[model samples]
Target: MKKGTLYLIAILWAVIVILPFLWALRISLIPTYTTFVSFFPKSLSELSLVNYEYLLFKTKFPRWMINSVLVSGGATFLNVLACSMLGYVLARKRLPGSNVIFTLVLALLMVPYHILVIALYLGLSKVKLTNTLFGVILPLSANPFGVFLMRQYITMIPREYEEAALVDGCSRIGALFKIVLPQALPAVGILTVTMFMETWNNFILPLVMLTKDSMKTVTVGIADLAFQTLNTNWGVLMAGSLLGAVPTVLVFVLFNRYFLRGLTLHGGLK
Candidate 1:
């Protein structure tokens, strides 16, 4: 395709991807009654902060936001720490049954998480972990995709770096922190952003694990807002959704450089 054609396609795709958020933003700014009346506001005068105000002050939205942050942030940190160590081991250690372990990890990537929900609920129930943030965080803390990503990226890095560190009397764990992890920043950024977004936006896991109103994450809380009343409050629901989406957006923006660099290197763009 021509360069101009490619640019046009890219622009169109961007618009397509952004339209829903734009609509949500539009709806969020207007009165709930006016939501279905038109796509575009008749005038700027129609816009108001009432929805945002109500969502913030008059509901459990703030508590839910805190819950989401705690759960998603905890899950992301654990995934990075666990996956990094496991990936390094699988890539460099050559431990017994390591190949079999990796194959099982690969198989896990093909298994849909939905199927595990029942088992997860049962096991957590047995441990009396249900209805707690830890329960939600624990299930999402380590991802097979994260393990696979880290292992593949770590393999591409030269062993000479860690070997030099080891010769300098650095412990194996020290070398991982001082040598391997620094070089794996791009992959770590990718893992951080992806895991945070996945956990932040997760609905099913939190919904099942947490039955208390105060323990609900932003996703489940917004869902409650949508169905809590006989008539749905579009304005408040959209407002909650927009706010709920902000963290993921900020996380992506903060780590986008690493994400782009990782993609470029992995894709041979340079």
Candidate 2:
């Protein structure tokens, strides 16, 4: 393709991706009743923060935001820790049945998690974990993709570094924490951002696990706002959506460099 054609395609794709957020922003600034009156505002005076104010103040949106943060943050942390250890073991240690375990992880990547929702709900209910933040976090704490990415990235790292550390009397765990993990920072960044976004935007799990309004994540809370009454408040719903998207955007921005570098390295390795 020509450079101009490629540029045009890129611009079109960018617009396609950004159009929804732009529309939401526009709707969020106007009154609820004015949402469908016109796509473009008639005057600058029509725009206001009334919807934002209502979402932030007269609703449980703040609590929902807190719940989302706790769930996403906790899940991300556990994914990083658990995936790293599992990836390291699968990549470096020749434990018995290690190949079988790795194969199972690969197989899990093919399985859709939605089908397991019933089992998850039943198990959590048995443990009295329903309607709790921890229940929501636990199910999202580990992912097959995270383990696969970490293992692939870790395999590319030089074993000589860990060998030298061992020769210097460093314990295996010490070498992992000191030598391996630091070098695997790029993969860790990718996992962190990915897990945080997935957990933050997750609706079904939190919706099923958390029946209490105070424990609902932002996504579920916003969904509730949409259907809580006879007439939907478009402005507030858009406002909540816009606000809910901010943290994921911030997380991506913070880790973008590492994410890109990890993908590049992983692709190069492949």
Candidate 3:
């Protein structure tokens, strides 16, 4: 009875989480005139791919999609690489001000990025990066949480592995590249998915930084669609949102095992 109740609760939770996406999916497929009161569309004739067609061909959405892919992928790559190196140094090597550095990283985790928006915008504007793709990517690339997560995961790795490599006459860089990195793959995967999701879903930063529609990320583009005019196309908006979610969904689906493994590091150690 308890097991059945638990399963019921889990199913309910799953429904709660997924129902919104399903509704959006339905909205995207149905005609803009069709009301959303039923489980599916009123009739087959009421459904079409017109919203997707408009989003793809008629708007700047394709450019936004390409820009989002580039920005998210680039930021994820840079964050993972830089975090791994900084994390390895912080985890393995004792250096002056290491504690202070780690503490600052942790402190930044508590500080919301929203607080820095104006400051970031002004700084990037000064550097003439405003309205550029790199303007969005550069600020998000070196997140402190990524550094902290990588640091914690690297610390969990057995130092004896690096020690063994050093005994084989491998230099620090070589050991880091050859030994530590392979061990940190799970953490790297987690950071990749995480950064991609955050960067892809980031609306405010991009909206503020990017003035040009051609350079806007998908989130910003979709939002601009919402606010650009009074008579917004709900169907296109839903379709754009659903399509924009695809890459992040794919990333999570592909790397979910690694993401879970990264989280369970301390569980095994304890």
Candidate 4:
């Protein structure tokens, strides 16, 4: 009876989560002028791709897509690489005042990121990067959470492996690449997905930093389309949102196994 009830609850929760996407998809397919009471279209004749057509051909959405990809990809790559290397160093190296540095990193994790936005904007503006993709990427690329997460994962690795590599004439950097990193791929994959998703979905920073229509990221671009003073395109907005979600979804799905492994926090070889 308990198992049956759990299954029932799971099904309900899944439906609750998926229902919004299904509704948006339905709205995307149905003609903008028509209203239907049911969950699905009334007939095949009522379905249309006009929203997608407008979204692709008539809007600056393609540019937004490109900008989003470049910015998100750049940010994720730098973040994962820097965090992993820093994490490995912090885990393996015992430099003077390292504990104080780690404590500062932990303290940073407690502070909300939004509090830094104004200061970041002012600083980036001074460097003439206010309207650039690099501005978006630079400010966000070295967050403490990624560093903390990677450090935690690296600590789980047995030091004996690094010791063995060192005895074989491997330098600290060499062992990081050949020994520690290879073992940390699962954690890295999870961090990549996380950083990519966060950067891709980031709205406020890009909205503030980028002034030109050509430089707008997808999230900001979609908001522009949705909030137009005249002829607001609800159908196109919904379609764009659904399509915009594809890459993040694909990243998670493609790295599903690694993501799960990262979450499980598996330790080094027995």
Instruction: Please name the candidate that would achieve the greatest lDDT relative to the true structure.
Output: 1
Model 1 residue pairs with clashes: none
Provide the overall lDDT of each model, using Cα atoms, as 2-decimal numbers: 0.89, 0.88, 0.85, 0.85
Q: Which stretches of candidate 2 lie over 4 Å from their true place?
A: 1-13, 35-38, 258-270
lDDT score, candidate 3, position 158: 92
Model 4 ranges off by over 4 Å: 1-6, 257-270
TM-score of every model versus the real structure: 0.88, 0.89, 0.88, 0.89
Question: Clash pairs of candidate 3?
Answer: none
In terms of lDDT, model 2 sits at 0.88
Candidates ranked by lDDT, best first? 1, 2, 3, 4
Per-candidate total of colliding backbone pairs: 0, 0, 0, 0
Candidate 1's C-alpha runs over 4 A off are: 1-16, 35-38, 257-270
* Pairwise TM-score winner, candidates 1 and 4: 4
Worst 10 residues of 2 by lDDT: 261-270
Weakest 10 consecutive residues of candidate 4 by summed lDDT = 261-270
User: What does the lDDT read for residue 198 in candidate 3?
Assistant: 81
